[model samples]
Target: MIGVGKMKQYTNVLDKPLTKGKQEVSLSAFAFLFSELVQYNQTQVDNIGELERRLEDAGYAVGARVLELLCHRDKGNRRETRLLGILSFVHSTVWKVLFGKVADSLEKGTEHEDEYMISEKELLVNRFISIPKDMGTFNCGAFVAGIVRGVLDGAGFPAVVTAHFVPVEGQQRPRTTILIKFAEEVLHREARLG
Candidate 1:
């Protein structure tokens, strides 16, 4: 066998310096890639709901990895434990990183103690999607919902995360709301912590 020199390894991911500024994913570029993801998933599912679910499942993995990387790299392995802290992280930190800005609103659910709502006037995924009437109201926010679930669940705050389109009184298009319902244990823990 011919003699081969050992390949030198570059700096580890943890050793790299954090980004100095926001990395912009242009709307056009993001739209193209997101459309491709939806199209690729379209072939695999029989119906719109399945397609959305698959997308959500795919996003769940991405969210889980994102949490791990951010915790280790950005936060120096510190993770948010409180409900509000994690929600703020998702609303501000995660949203800023992914969508280039903080979400429009983060509101406590009026009817429920365990629920919260994260609303965006124009969600990144919904901006790129154009579903037909026959297909029904298929909100692409499901994928984002999965991402939130993954982040919360990975951080030890298990919850049921979902997305819905709520109408805006004056706007022609509806806004997306990511609804998170915390598990019983999570609520209990929050009570204890309080």
Candidate 2:
């Protein structure tokens, strides 16, 4: 077994410089890995909610780190201070980095004062996922929502993020709607600072 001291001696890969050029991962490799992730999580949980929670928890850490890297790559390591600015950053930069394309749209909720939606025709993460009918409303996009939540929380904007499947009439791939509900304190702060 590796000792704690020995483990600590390894260099942090995040601190290493990224090579300048296109570095793309194969979709098949990602899909296989993700499918294994789901299968492993499913064995540990008795219900869909628990499985989703496990997946989300796994994605959260990745999201936090991705936010830092994305900010470094796109904004010269500067964090967005405004609500809309952060949303726009996620919609464009984050989407591009993760999916090689931007999200289809970003829209504010009409009924709620502090809700925002990011819609995607086909989220890469859910490209090969097929939820059975018995799974009820289970959506693999919850992992992405958790990533969004982690990014927001790391940026000092706490929010609850959830994913819903909404199929479009003409779209081949079903739409994924990531709902972001900001905390009361965040809204109050935004109002005061806006």
Candidate 3:
């Protein structure tokens, strides 16, 4: 209404309730859409960083919405206030919402003071995507990292999330590790409030 002032008011089409039992979408459809999204971003960038950054930016918005919806739906509209509590929510609940399954692993950094990791075997975002040699070191999992960053940031835990491809023994597919490094201020707050 703010931008389309002269247009006649149209009935809201999204008012219908989601009465269907399962709210899942076809994986094939998701793959196609994600491929198109990657292609679109690829065309707009000249370097790998720009491409990954764009993809991450797109996911950031979705993650913001997801954080709100997940908190409202699963946490009874309450937000997690502790470090491990929030990480558990992300590793279990958020992963389940996005991939229909929990993440493979969640671990704290032994060397770092305030760092965490979420690993996924065969990340859905990279399922149908193949990185070109020219793109060198580019991984589509950055989008998922950005989503994690967005969710953590929105929940008052500012962090930097990066995705890396790790080869797992006895596993045919690569594992994607999302490294989350929380800000010093956030760590201080977590300690003070924890």
Q: Highest lDDT among the candidates is held by which one?
A: 1
Q: Is candidate 1 or candidate 3 better by TM-score?
A: 3
The top-ranked prediction according to TM-score is: 2
* Better model by TM-score: candidate 1 vs candidate 2: 2
Q: Which lDDT values do the candidates have, in the order given? A: 0.86, 0.85, 0.85
RMSD list, candidates in order: 6.4, 5.8, 6.3
Instruction: Please write out the lDDT profile of model 2 over residues 1-194, one tens digit for every residue.
Output: 22434333328876656433454567998999989988898899998888888888887887898898877776787999889999998898887887888899999999999999999888898888888888988988888998898889889899989999988897665689999999999999999997
Error of 3 at 33 (Å): 0.6
Cα-based lDDT at residue 53, candidate 3: 93
Sorted on TM-score, best first, the list reads 2, 3, 1
Location of the lowest summed lDDT over 10 successive residues in candidate 3: 13-22
Q: How close is every model to the real structure, measured as TM-score?
A: 0.87, 0.89, 0.88
List candidate 3 segments past 4 Å from native: 1-21
Candidate 3 lDDT over residue span 1-194, tens digit each: 13345444548846543222355777888999999998899899998899889988888887888888888777778998888888998999888888889999999989998889999888988987777777777889989998998899899888888898888999876788999999999888878885
Cα misplacement distance, residue 143 of candidate 2 (Å) = 0.9
Which regions of candidate 2 deviate over 4 angstroms? 1-15, 170-173
Pitting candidate 1 against candidate 2, the one with the higher lDDT is: 1
Stretches of candidate 1 off by over 4 Å are 1-16, 20-22
Expressed as tens digits, the lDDT of each residue in 1-194 for candidate 1 is 12223433447966556553435546787778888888899999998879978988988887898788778767889999898999999999888777878999999999999999999999988885776888787888888998998899899998898899999999989999999999999999999999
